[model samples]
Target chain A: MDDAPNSEHFTLSPIGHMVSDYPDKFGIPRQPGLAPAANAKLVLAAPYNDPLAVRGLEDFSHLWLSFIFHQSPQRWSPLVRPPRLGGNKKVGVFASRSTHRPNRLGLSLVRLVGIDTQQGVVLALQGCDLVSGTPVVDIKPYLPWAESQPDAKAGFAPQTPSLLAVSFHPAALDTLTQRSDSATLHALIEQVLSQDPRPAYKQKELASKRLYGVRLRDVDVKFRQRQQGEATTLEVMAIEPYDER
Target chain B: MDDAPNSEHFTLSPIGHMVSDYPDKFGIPRQPGLAPAANAKLVLAAPYNDPLAVRGLEDFSHLWLSFIFHQSPQRWSPLVRPPRLGGNKKVGVFASRSTHRPNRLGLSLVRLVGIDTQQGVVLALQGCDLVSGTPVVDIKPYLPWAESQPDAKAGFAPQTPSLLAVSFHPAALDTLTQRSDSATLHALIEQVLSQDPRPAYKQKELASKRLYGVRLRDVDVKFRQRQQGEATTLEVMAIEPYDER
Candidate 1:
């Protein structure tokens, strides 16, 4: 028998790369801007390094990011169960935000913090859920006038996410105090863990584990998952910024 | 050896069917809303017949329609040349609106003319570029407050399409006059032909006697291509409604 034919291929050059504190996907928020204090940086590629590219961008409080899901495997399926739908009901992949798609492109709206053009081009952004080292395909300044709709229907994910009440362990708090920017680090950690970023089904299995630690933005986030009747709770243990060895 | 695996083993039950005056693909505006007078109808499926599902739709003047490119062949390439980009420069299939896709789903924004709950939950739409039998998967009301961005940057395709000047033959005008709704029919015919729907690089052979005809809505348009000074021109010969035998 003859060898099977290989599918066609193409190369995509990233316009920029994302640098965030979250090195792995395990604890990253499901959607960008879900954790407001989670900051990330954008390092522009050559030829795109012109400061003029970012001119008039600072006026906008937020920006839209177009990026590739470079890590997702190539195989695809027609249907995918969305985590937002409790991961039980099956829906067409095109109707849901599943990483397994015909094309692995992803679009996310992120908050723009600050831009620095002095050394190449670095954009400081907050609430960036992208994993560290993720390649950004394109970035455009967001027009709030055209994008904000208070009355628009959100379909199944209509309910706004609830704010979680959290408390930190005294020891974990001590580790954070040793950092120069302890307040900022503490706030960032609290914001992320409070959202209960774990996969929905995973909650039942991890119920007995009192302390959960996640390393993000060069900090170790220790938290405890508790249950008060029907309500699920997450208590922050401590946020300690890593020390360079 | 075992029987070869079947590559084409799938059936799609259309969630709903689209009925547009654009009986054929040729000369339909490349983008919807370009021809305001053009209208179409959508008929939903059995289980989706509840009128209550459309309760909050009246507030929006437009909508996002997710549909399948049922006419396109099932297989696809990784890259495709977009007709909007002059059909020479190749872009990833995901980036172009080319029908050949891993999953042949299409997204179009169309103007909502009106909704009729009394008659089988039908929705009348204007400026729809979809063909008559296109299958619609889902419909979401367009929130202009969150969607319209005059300042937002568009890649490849500019916000407004370039327009071309057109002239029709007297014979074609005479034929159109004999129709019951001649005035409306002529206006619709002129709007469609002016868009220059011919494929790029289609003039490969110079067969002087050949005439091309495009069927639209309730009319048949016959035209001949000719050179006039520095520009190519289409000389219309006749416009008649399709006579079903």
Candidate 2:
């Protein structure tokens, strides 16, 4: 093996950052493609914003984004408790896609809805789970022949995430009617609530009257989950403009 | 929306390097899983070599490897000529999966064969395209539910690689009969040659009698391509131990 010097470390400067719908880590979905309506805009920085840098990128329908988990803790552990495993069982950090690892690298596959160059190079993306201001390191077009693996075994996480039923209150429905792009934001709220975005312990509590606030776009969505015997449903109480207090 | 400071720069150090069958960059497949017989061993460096760090990873059948193109030049271009496109027409660097880009990051999907830690943390991988001593920055298990996309539209690279016919010379066949793992090596040589591992311009030459050499393992594999009428065939001339001078 070739043991040469200067190969030990590598530096990656952000080519761009995402202005996604996700405001914080509290309500963001764990993985992409679950919420297809959660769209984001990727804005390229400084010299990289040259239109020539993404000349033929429009031809690609999907792309792979290599990004940094900027919000994860700097200290890492050898083992991690995956939320999918009920956040109890321990598995090697590599076995689970945990952000707190030796490296804070994150990989995601996003559908390219459209590419715009009005002000700078801005890309409209769908099915993204990254938060706003997430630093993107590299972007590559997805090769179907080389990457598609439908029959692969998924060890622990076998099934797709189960969805919960969601309903809107009279006040929340009124808020949607007054908005111009209410149809888009309405779908985003329904999809985000369907994933049951709550801690394992909170999800297990029977009929706990905890009103959770999820920030979607510029509104603070206040909702609560109710359990009637074996069935559970999330109902939105109100939707108001977020106040940074 | 977020103008956070210290979020633009990221640093990644090598967790380990691969000791693969490919000795140099001359004959390695452009994409992984091209040559199933081609195997490699990834030896983890200290601190990352802890056995607990890889626990439960055996359950997953495949993994994603994030590596650096250390052998490539530090300079990059916005446009690239892909060999898949006959190396004539140029495409934006982002449209193609060329190693030369804004960042030197390379992503590959490989099947995890086995993991051994008798001496250190050595992982046996199948269907890799990386050369020996290739530095790896991160490893993550493949999530079938989140990452699988068989219906994706590939803009340029739409089809799987087409392979050519490969034959062994009398001396080359004789050399295989004397080796212990000839079956494995024989299949690797045939699969490698089937891809027509020659420059696009060289493949168009009028049956030029130029002999080519590819180093596989510790041997120098001498081969040539023969053209007749409209059919082309590659033949192995000899398999001899390579000498470094």
DockQ score of the complex predicted as candidate 2? 0.65
What are the fnat scores of the candidates, in the order listed? Answer: 0.03, 0.67
Candidate achieving the largest TM-score: 2
Q: Best lDDT goes to which candidate?
A: 2
Per-prediction backbone clash count: 3, 0
- Poorest 10 consecutive residues by lDDT, candidate 1 chain B: B1-10
Q: Candidate 1 regions off by >4 Å?
A: A1-245, B1-13, B149-153, B203-210
Backbone clashes in model 2, listed as residue pairs: none
**Weakest ten-residue segment in model 2 chain A by summed lDDT:** A1-10
Fnat of model 2, as a fraction: 0.67
* Candidate 2 CAPRI grade: medium
DockQ each: 0.07, 0.65
- TM-score of the second chain, each candidate in turn, equals 0.86, 0.95
